[model samples]
Target: MTTWDLAVVGCGPAGSATAMGALRVDPTLRVVLLDRAEFPRDKACGDGIAPQVVDLLEDAGVRGVVDGHVPVPRLRLDRGAFGVDRTMARPAWVIPRTVFDQRLVEAAQAAGATLRRHRVRELAQPSSVVLDGEVEARTVVGADGAYSTVRRALGLMPGPMAVALRGYAPTPANRANAQVIAFGTAGQPAYAWSFDRGDGLANVGYGELLGHRHDRPTKAQLRERLDVLLPGASDGGTGWKGHQLPLSSGRWRPPTGRILLAGDAAGLVNPMTGEGIYYAVATGFAAGRAAAEALIAGAPASAGARYARATRRLLAGHLRHVAAAAGLSRHHRVIDAGLRASAADQRVFDDLVELGLARGRITPTMARGLARELAGAARRRPVRRRR
Candidate 1:
């Protein structure tokens, strides 16, 4: 049996990014990437990448792909009767997961990581994954998404999940060059987004915290609202998809063996916004580097634990901050008020998505700006002019 340096259990952005980082640290280490689905697979996602993600791609020797990313600069946010419009000069890209995930996988292969297409049926720890009852490696990375098999094998329990649904459509002219976020006041925290894909197409989706309802809107009911929002593009829409975002950051303990979890497996996605791609990619890189260092230091079994500690150090505070924000979002009335106040100043909207660029916490400047705007809005309103 030939032993390999690492086996990555998923081919998503996180898995591929980790493999690339590992190879960068030690080019000679043999890395294998395994995934149940093949390249170019479609995933239900908002498909927007922040500029910071661009930096990570560049660091992984993938600048060419980042340069080719589709741009969406204007952001429009709505919460009930209040709304705000903002332009993003820093740049955000709308790269479909199909194209984006494939490129990352190919990049990993080009960087010398082996690609394996097989559903990972099991993970027998202490050091091995049973993929289709076969392939095995000394060290493993579980980048598999929500409900990750690797996480399960490691006995890592995930926290509550955020359910999201999305699909592709013809880019409406009115929606071109901008993205839309509509917040729901009553129910399981619903929000619909429209991101222009630049190729005469757009990605539109709705996300809500699962099992909580405000107005009896079923999945179909909420989707119908989206259909109205996107207009002509929503007609003949056959692509209905949904996925879960694991929010709890899980147990923070990788299995007591040479297996580490990355991406959704590690529950790194933000609870409030369902944004995990960038964090997953960042943590995956950290994991890969830690694993490679462990291997080079002649400590294979401790690699998993080392990866966990490194990932926690890199993300624990950020996760806590995101959780606080998400909790606020759940209180719809307060968030709605915030959104109304934010309309006068767009930085509040920017701070929401740009949390990644801000290193997870909203800056004091942004916080003070938001506070002033809210206070001013409160002062400006006529004292209950009841007609």
Candidate 2:
């Protein structure tokens, strides 16, 4: 078996991005990407790509394919009777995972990484992977998602996680270019979403943290909510599908030995919004760079440590905030109040959205606004004297 410099398991955004990032740094590095599914395979997702994701895709040499996506210039947030609609300064795009993932796979191949369609069954010592046979690699990256065989092979148990179900409905003529997110009812700690694919179809779904104390919404409940929000959309639950999201809780432990994990395999999804693509690409790039550097330096053992440090540096603060938000979301009434406040205050709305997207941090001004809002609510409460 030909020993390769890197073997990336899973060819989704993370795996492909790892291969592409590695080869871009050193074209001579031999990289092989393996996946059980072939290109153009559908994956259950929200199908919404943020602006930062576009930047990553462009850097990976897949910008041309993005033109096929539907431009989403506006975002709508709804919580009970309060709602806010705002135009994104940088527009996002809606594209099916089948189409989007294939482009990334093609880009990885174009970057000189070999693509193999095989299911990885086991992991061997000294950075080797076993499939139909043993293939030695100087380093290995686990980009496989939530139910990552690679992560389990490394004996890493994930912390808190989420389960999401999404399906497509015919897009309403009036909502062709808008994206909508609706917060779940009190105590649910989840949200439902609808993204207009601009191809006469809208992606609608709901997600909740696994093991949450509150009851998880059923497909029927999700359908009913979609009907209320989009009216006549998703009325019959035609094509609903479910997937797992391994949320980051800021307690990540690096995989034992030399194996490196990135993307969902490492539980890198944003807890606040269940967004995985951006983190996948970011961590995949970091893993690739770290692996390439370690391989060139003849220090495979250092790869895990280096990758861990890089991930901490990149995601520690964001993960902390997201974890906090996830915890607070358990009290849905607080979230509802926050949403109402956001609807009434533009700065509050931007800050809240930015934090949810991991685009920016909470500023002092936003904090002050929140404090004032809380104080006012307290004053409005009728004083009750001890009887």
TM-scores, one per candidate: 0.89, 0.91
RMSD values for the candidates in order, in angstroms, are 3.3, 2.5
Model 2: how far is 59 from its true place, Å?
3.7
lDDT, candidate 2, 72-164, per-residue tens: 988888877777787777778888899889888888898899988878888777435454466678788999888898898878888777878
Supply the TM-score for candidate 1: 0.89
lDDT (0 to 1) per candidate: 0.75, 0.79
Q: What lDDT is reached at residue 109 by model 1?
A: 94
lDDT score for residue 251 of model 1: 33
Report RMSD for candidate 2.
Answer: 2.5
Off by over 4 Å in 1: 67-69, 126-133, 212-219, 228-233, 249-256, 356-358, 370-387
Clash numbers, per candidate: 1, 0
Error of model 1, residue 174, in angstroms: 1.9
Worst 10 residues of 2 by lDDT: 126-135
